[model samples]
Structure formats: C-alpha cells, structure tokens
Target: MGHDLNLNAMNYFEAVARLGGVSKAAEELGVSASAVSQQIRQLEQQFGVRLFRREKRRLILTLDGERLFQTTTQAFRMMRDVRSAIVRQRENRHFIMRVSPSFGVRWLAPRLKGFLDANPGWDLRVDGAPDFSDFETEIVDLDLRYGAGDWSGLHQEAVVHDFVLPMCSPSYLAELKEQSGDPIGQLLKARLIDSVKTHFRWDFWLARHGAMGGRMVYPLRFDRSNMAIQVAADGAGVVLESATLAINELERGDLVPLSRAFAVIKVPTYWLVCPSRHTNRRIVRLFSEWMRKEGSAHDDKTADMLRSLGCTIQEEESTILNRDIDDARQ
Candidate 1:
C-alpha cells in the first residue's frame, strides 16, 4: 500500500464504521453516498485491508474495522471532554438550558439577572425553542418542559405548578370603571384576547365564574400566548394567561387581574428535565437546585403580596419527581 493516505478519508471511514452504513454516514456528514464509498475505499487501500464486508445491503464491520472503531470512539470522547473542559475553564462553568419560548420570555428572562449575579462567569446557553429530543444528541445540560415531567430518559425535577388568570391593562380597567358600573360586566363587553393554540379565552374563565351567558368578541387572536398577553397589555382586550407568565408584568403595574375568575389549569408547570443520569455535572445540579429554589421563592413572594392586600391566597406546590401524573387525562 502507498503511504499518502489522508485523515479526511479515515474520518469518512470511521463515520461509516460507527454508523454501520456508508449511505447513512454520508447523509449525516452531508455528502453523497458515492463520495463516502470512495473515501472508505481509499482508507482500505492505504491500510492494505478491507475494513468492512458487504452482505446484501448490510455493511458488516471486519476485524480491522472493529479495532479502528474502538480507538476512534475513545478519541472522539476525549476530544469532546477536552472541548467541554476548556469551555468550563474559560467561563468558570458551562450551562445550557432548554426552555419553551413563552416560559423563557415571560418568566425566566426577567429573573435571569439574579442567576447571573449569583453565578458570575458562568456560561449559559438558553434555548427558548422547545424541541428536546436533540438535547441528548447535542449534549445539552438541562431542559425545562411544561408538563407532567414524564420525559422517559431524563432526570426530572418539578419547579412550579401554575394557574391561568384573567389579566388586562390597568388603563382598560380604568376605562371599564368609567363606562360601566360593574367591572366584570364591562369585561364581558370588552374585546377578548385569544391565545389560539392554547385554546384559552374568556369563555373558559366565564364558565368557571358561572357567567357563561355572554357571546365573546375578539379583536385579535394570537398564535402565541405571549402575543396575546402583549395585546392585553396594549389595552386591546382581556387575556386569560398563566399567572406565572404574567407575574412580572403584574408586579410592574403593566397588567392587572380583572377579577377572581381564574380556574385551576393543569398546563404550564415548570419541570427541570435532563438525561435520566449524569448527576455528576456540578453545573447541571446547581442550576436545577437554583430553578427549584427560585420558583419557590416567587411563589412565596406572590403569597406574601396577596396577604399584604388583605386577601388569603392558597398556595399549591409540588416537586417534579413527586407530581401526580395519574390524573393526566382527567
């Protein structure tokens, strides 16, 4: 065999060996099947041995291929560890958290200052888009999902349980008070902002309030819950949204509760989810604990605000690991 072999050819061969097929490896590497085959052929010619035996469509790894795969696997893992360690050393610690868009924007985004203040020099990548299947493949450290925390292969921690409540701009409320004797009646007349995908509207709250008589009107319907809340803030309408989402706006006097027409909603709880194992990443552990503790702190703050207002508020809480999943369909 001639000794002018290329590392690039070996990489293609390694991909084929690990994936068990030239075509699949080519697809993953964004190259043509023929190109991958050519690279494998070049590698085998250089090594003076066939790395794989073709049986029908299957590419069975030969003895040489197996030996190469074991070595390459270790090499790849070591390379990954070195990259991660370098990043950690530069930033103190690395944290990548995946969370839903609305949750991240409405809740997490506003409160991240504290986390940043506490964990100075920590590198964090917050993915607001909610596809988590690739989290494992991408080596993501943590994911936050809004559900019962039934992620099959993740270490799950429940952060907070949430409820939907009627919210509107204070200006809208003032207008109602000026025009109508009863704010609830005026709210029924005001434009109703709809979160189209979540199927949340004033009718849902009206049903809970025993005033399901009015035909709701909508000036705008938003596909995103955040957009609907934005419209409500602009005095476009009254929006029914998760209290946790609207908390910052409410505290800042941007949004106000219209009435006590909020029903207990099953959706929109904070769950700290990640791959079922790997408790060894100190960054992951620290972020998870911080999420749970901070979520609890927010709940307590809400309860305290309610108490100061001369209203007794009942606070419900649950951990992700212990949340009741039996009533999912109920």
Candidate 2:
C-alpha cells in the first residue's frame, strides 16, 4: 500500500503529543479537537501503524506514536527556527530579547529607553513571560534571567546579584505613621505578602532581625512576583520582594521600604542568559554589557533613590540589596 503522509497530519499529531491531548493541541493551534484527531488518524494510516489507543476515552500514544512524536518534535522545532530566521530578516530593526516577567517590568523596561535613545538605529522587541525554557522555542535572541547562573545548554553572563526585602507603598507607610507610631510593628500584626515556597523567603530576611512566625493572611497570593509587587503597591500588604523588582517603585516613590526594620540580604542575581550558539551576536554582546552595568549598579541607584527620600542605608552593609523574586506561581 502506497501511503503518503501529509505535513498537516504530522503537524497536528505533533501538537497533540506535545500538549498531551487533541483538545489542548487544538486550543493551542486554534483549531478543533476533531480536526486534530482526523489528522492524527490520517498520519497513522500513512505510516501503516496505529498511532494512538483509547484508554478510558483518553488518547494515549502508542509505541509507534512515541517514536514519531520524538522525530516530529525536533522537526517542528527546526522548522520554527527557520521561520523565525526569515521573520528576523524582514524585521531587521534590532534585537528580539526575551525576559522573565518581573525582571522585564522592574528592570529592563525602564533601562530600555537609555539603550534605544543611545542607539537610535537599533530596534528591540522585548518578550516577557514567566517561563524561561521558552527562550529557545520562542527564538529569543537574549534573556535577562533571575537565577544562580546555571542554565543548561546556554551562555549565561552575570548581570547583578540580588536580595529580598520588605516593601510597601509610600502612601501606606504614611498612613501607618498617622495611624500608629511603629508601622513595622503594625505590619507584623498584619499579613506579609508572600510568594509560594521558593528559594527566597521572608523567614530568611526576618531571621536577621530575630523576627519570625507572624500570622500571615494572604489577601492575594500571586504566583507572579510582578503581580505581588503591584498588589503590595496597592496597600494589599507589606510584600517581601526582591530589590530588583521594587527598584523602580522605590525610585518612583510608589513603593518604599516598610521601615528601618527591613534589611537587605544576599540572594540570586540576574544574568544575560541566551543560547551559547549566538554569543558573538553584536546586539547580544551590547545588551549583555549594558545589563551588567545596569544590574550591578542597581544598588547604587536604589541607594541614591532611597537616600533622597531620607532613608539612610548603612554603607557597612550592601545597601539596596538585590535578589530574585522569580516566584513559581502555582
């Protein structure tokens, strides 16, 4: 039997396998589940093997399906990259950079103007999301990430080390002052906005001041650090966030350190992470250099912003501590 496999069938089958079901794959591809199922069946007929089996009304990939799926995964990824390359040429304005959401909002977004203002001809498209693994799949040219400089199969360049601390809106601090003498003491009585269980925590910071085990009421428990920071600015609670995330707000007087009680501590830092394959790319090199200067100097800038607000930071300690607020949202 001469069976010719259709490219569309292979595409649909690949999406279904990657997404675990036809329904999900259809949603991702903006199609109908029945359409995906028909395509998968067509692929199976072409290959002369059963691709899937119904297990309690759920599609389960057969052994043949598994093998085909593996091959198709790489095939699709390569094709996507080729497509991206073509798109890149047509959009020849500047670099397309990918960044984690909080990092982009708190750090890169503000600094972007300076880069663009200096290099008027270099166009940049910044893609922000929580998932770092998508860098390769999404064809991101560069990444500004918050981690321990340990991204597998990628070139990682240091930007700045980070630390976590308490932050609240300046208005919230003012109101607390008018309401009570000690706002930190008052906050201790209220909820401390917390991220889900992760590397950075309030216990780490609180332990420095010998404070612990306070009642926590999550008015909002957001998985995204950026959202938590925004809610904190809305006077939701005193959020224990990264200096990196709060830098802009602190500088803008939108969010401020809860009180002198807050102490900055050492935590994970941001890195200019990207595929090592493109290390020599001029734009990537330029962006990485700019990131190092901007990220490392975050402390100095935050200190200046803090000092201008009459918040004296101790020089003996690393003032304006930077840290990772890349919380895993569940």
Best by TM-score: 1
lDDT of each: 0.71, 0.71
Which pairs clash (backbone N, Cα, C closer than 3 Å) in model 2?
94-123, 162-322, 162-323, 163-322, 163-323, 223-329
Compared with the true structure, what per-residue lDDT tens digits does model 2 show for residues 55-108?
A: 997888899989989999999999999999998788776688777777777677
Q: What is the lDDT of residue 259 in candidate 2?
A: 74
Model 1 lDDT tens row, 1-330: 336758678778878887889888999889999999998888888788888998998999899888987887777668869999897788676687788788888888888998889878887889887566466468677778776555676777777656556778989978877777675677667777777654245555565465555565567777777888878888877887766777667777788877543333434367887765655788777777788898888766765543443433433443321333222212
Score every model by TM-score. Answer: 0.59, 0.57
* Stretches > 4 Å off in candidate 2: 1-94, 120-123, 134-138, 161-163, 174-184, 197-199, 214-217, 266-268, 307-330
- Candidate 1 error regions (>4 Å): 1-93, 148-153, 178-184, 197-203, 214-217, 260-268, 307-330
